[model samples]
Target: MLTFVAAVSTGFPAQAQNDRATTTVDYTVRVNDTLYDLASYYLTDPGCWTVLKKLNRVADPKHLQPNSTLRIPLALLKQSLLAARAIAVSGSVERTLGQGPFLPLNFDAALTEGDHVRTGPNSFATIQLSDGSHVTLHANTTILIKHLRATVLNGIVDRQFELNQGEVETKVTPLKPQDRYNIISPSVIAGVRGTEFRVVYGDGAGAGNTAVEVLEGKVAAQGPNAPPVLVPQQFGVISDSAGNVGAPIQMLPAPSLAEPGQVQKGLQIVFEIAAMPEARAYRATIATDAGFLHIVNEIRAESPRALFDDMPSGSYFVRLSAIDRNGIEGLSQIYSFRRARPSEASAAATRTANFEFRWTEDAHAGAGAGAQQTYRFVLATNSQLHDPMLDQTALAGTRLVLSDLKPGKYFWSVAAAVSPNNGESHEKPASIRSFTVGQ
Candidate 1:
C-alpha cells in the first residue's frame, strides 16, 4: 500500500532546528584534480578553495595525491532549499502553509518546510521531493515538513518529517555520502540514507509509539535517550512512549493474493489474500496509479478478506500487505482490477407473469463505451442457491420474463456477466430475492 502519514500537530519553523549537528562528506582526490576545480564543482563558491586547502592541509592544491579522500563539510557545499511537488493527489488531501488553516491540496502543489499535510479517510497523496524521492501518504495520515534541504552538487538531501500520527511509505533515491532522511515520531526517529521503507506512529499495538519497517535498505531507529537500533531489510523496530527502542523485529513476508482482481462486478470490491499465521491484520490500498502514488482508499481487517466501499466503474490498483504483531507493516504486493457498476437486480411476480426480473446496467451500455453486461438468472428452492430449478445464462436484455413456475416459495438471483473486451470474463451475482407463489 502507499502508506503516507498524518500529523496531529505542526512544527515550528525549520529555522528553530538549526541546532542539528553539522555534517561532512568525503571527496576522493582523483588524479589531475586541482583544489580549485574541486571547490568549483562541489562548493557554492570556488573561492572556498582556501578553506578546503586549510581543512585538508593540501599545501599544494595543484598536485594532490590521487585516491586520497578529503573531508568536505556540508556547511561549505553548494546547497539549496527544496520543496515537494504533489504529483498525485487523490480524495481529501489537505495542506496548510505553516500554521495557517488547511486548504484542499491538489496536484502540482509545492510543499516546503514547515508545511503540514494530512489525508482524510480514504484519501491519499504522493509527493516527489527535489531529489527524485517519492513519499506516498496513505489514508488518515498527517505529517509536518520539518526540513527539506539538499546539497545540489552531490545529490545529498536532508529531509526531516515529523509524524504526529499515522503512517507513510517512501521510495528514496540513493543518497550521496553524508546525506540523511529522517522521520521523527512521538518517541523515536526513523532514519535512512537511501531506501524504501515505512514509518508509523500513534496507531496499532504501539499507540503513541513509533514503528519503522525497512523494505529495502536499512533503517536506524533511535529514541530520544536510547541508542539506535539497526533494522535491516524485512525487519522492523518499535519505540515506546518512553523513547525506548525495541529489538529488531522480523517482518512478515508478503502474502499472496488468492485470486487476481482483474474484474469486479459488485456493490463492494473485495480482495482476499492467503492467511498468514502471524499476521495481526491485513491492509489493502486502492489507487489509480500502479505506483500507488494516488492512493484513493484503504482498509484494514483482521481476516484475509479486504473489502472497499462501492467505487465508480473504472480501473484501479490495489496493494496488499500484512501487519505483524508489533504493529509494523510487511512487504506488499500490488494488483490491478476493473470495477463494473451496479451488480444488483430486482425481481417481481406480476399478476399475469409468473416471474419478472430486471437488472441494472451501466449508463454507458453500448459499443465503444465497453459496458455491455449480459446476465444469468438462477432460481432455486433454497437460499444456498443449490439444486437450482431454473438456471439461465446469456440473457442480454435487462428484463427477464419467466412463466409456468410451480407454486412454492422460491429464491432467485441475477448475476451480471461483464466482458471487458480484454479477453477476460467475469460473472458476479447479485443478492438473492425470494417470492411466494399461490398454492
Candidate 2:
C-alpha cells in the first residue's frame, strides 16, 4: 500500500540550490515523484534517471517517499561546473577588468582571468574558484586573478592569483591533486595543493616583503634568488624586499584562552593565553573574521596575556602569535569570543506617542568582575534592523526616547559596552522587544 502525504514544511523550490563550488540542485521529492520525473524536470533529459538513481544509491525509484530531499547532480548541465565568482564581499570593494578603471564589486560578480580586485580600508572580499577553492582578501588589499580555467573533460583547474599588496587567506580544495594553484607576491611565490594558508605582501617593516604562513598543509615559498622553502603545517617563511627567501620558522603554539572563559559582559576584551615555553612576547589582533583581514584592534604583551579596552560590544576573533627573541613572528592561533552588554527592555505606554526604551546594565562577570560597563541602544521597525529608526551608541544612560513615532509595530534592542570607542568589537544585542504605539 502506497500513501501520499504532504507535510506543511515540504514546500520548496522545484529547482533550488545553494551556491557552493559544486554545481548541484537541492530538490524535494513530491508525492508520487520518481527519479525520471526529477531528471526530466531539472535536466530536461529523462535519460539521466539512471545517473541520478546511481548517484543517490536508490535501487528502487518507485519507493521514493514524499518530502524526501535529494541532491540532483548537474553533470548533464555542461559548462555549469566551470564558474569563477565572488561568494561574499564586505565594506568598500572594487574590481577592474583589464585596463579599465575600478568599479564597485558586486556580491554576485563573476571573476575571470586578468580581473583585479581590491578592498578598501577595513573591508574584505571572498572569491570562489572553479574548483571550489576560496581566497579571502584582507582590507586595503589588491589582487589580480592571473589565471582561472579548467578542462571540462579532466576537471583539472589552474588557478593563480597575484597579490599586489596586503594579505590573503586561501582554502584550496583537495579534490584535484594535479591542479595548479599559486599566490604570487612582488617578492615571492607560494604554491599549495589542497591546503589552507595565508600570504601577506609588503607587510613587514621593509618594503616589498612577503610572508607565507601555512596553517594546514605544506606550502612551497620561493624567492627570486633564494631556494624554495617548504612551509609545513604550523610553520612560516618570509621573503625580504630584495626577494631573498628566509628559512622556515615554527609558528607559535596556540594558547588556551584564560580570561573571558566562555563569554564576557563588557566592551573590553580581556585576553589571557596559556603560557608557552618558546614564546617571549605575544602579539594579539582582534578582527571580525577568522582570517584576521578585518582587524579592529591589536595589542602586544610581554607575557602570554594582552588587554583590549574601550572597544564596543560585539563578536570578535582574537588572533595570537608568539614572537621569538629574534623578532620572527610565528604562526597564529585564532579564538572567537563575544563582548556583550545585556540590557532589559522597559515597559511602554500607549496613551502618548512618546516611547522610552531602557535595558539592563553591563555586569562584567567571569574572571574580570567589577569592571565598569557601558550601554548602547537601537530601535528599529524590522527585526534585522537594516536602517534603524533610532540608533544611539556610547550612551551612558540605560534609557532612550523617541518623541513622535507613528502608530505601528516597533522592535528595540540594546547592548552593553565598556567604552565609547567603537573598535572592531561586535556586541551581540539583547533579545528584541516589540511594542505598539497607536491602534
Clash number by candidate, in order: 12, 11
Cα lDDT over the full model 1: 0.70
lDDT values, one for every candidate: 0.70, 0.62
Q: Name the top TM-score candidate.
A: 1
Mind giving the per-residue lDDT tens digits that candidate 2 earns over 1-439? 0000011111111211232224555568789988876666555456878877887788788778788877765445322224567766777899996678999998768878878999997677777664436788877899998867554433545566888998888876553454557777766556665677888776442466677777777866544334445667877776677766677788776555555334445445567777788877887776654433345566668898687666655455577777665445676655555555433112112122334443433333111254445556777888777699878876766455556566455667766653324454456335554543322
TM-score of each: 0.63, 0.52
lDDT of 1 by residue, 327-433 (tens): 88887765555567564222112123234454443222222354445678888989889999889987766566566565555677767665556777666435565
Query: Residue 4 error for model 2, in Å?
Result: 59
The C-alpha stretches of model 1 lying farther than 4 A from their native spots are 1-73, 76-78, 152-155, 223-227, 343-439
- lDDT score of residue 7 within candidate 2: 16
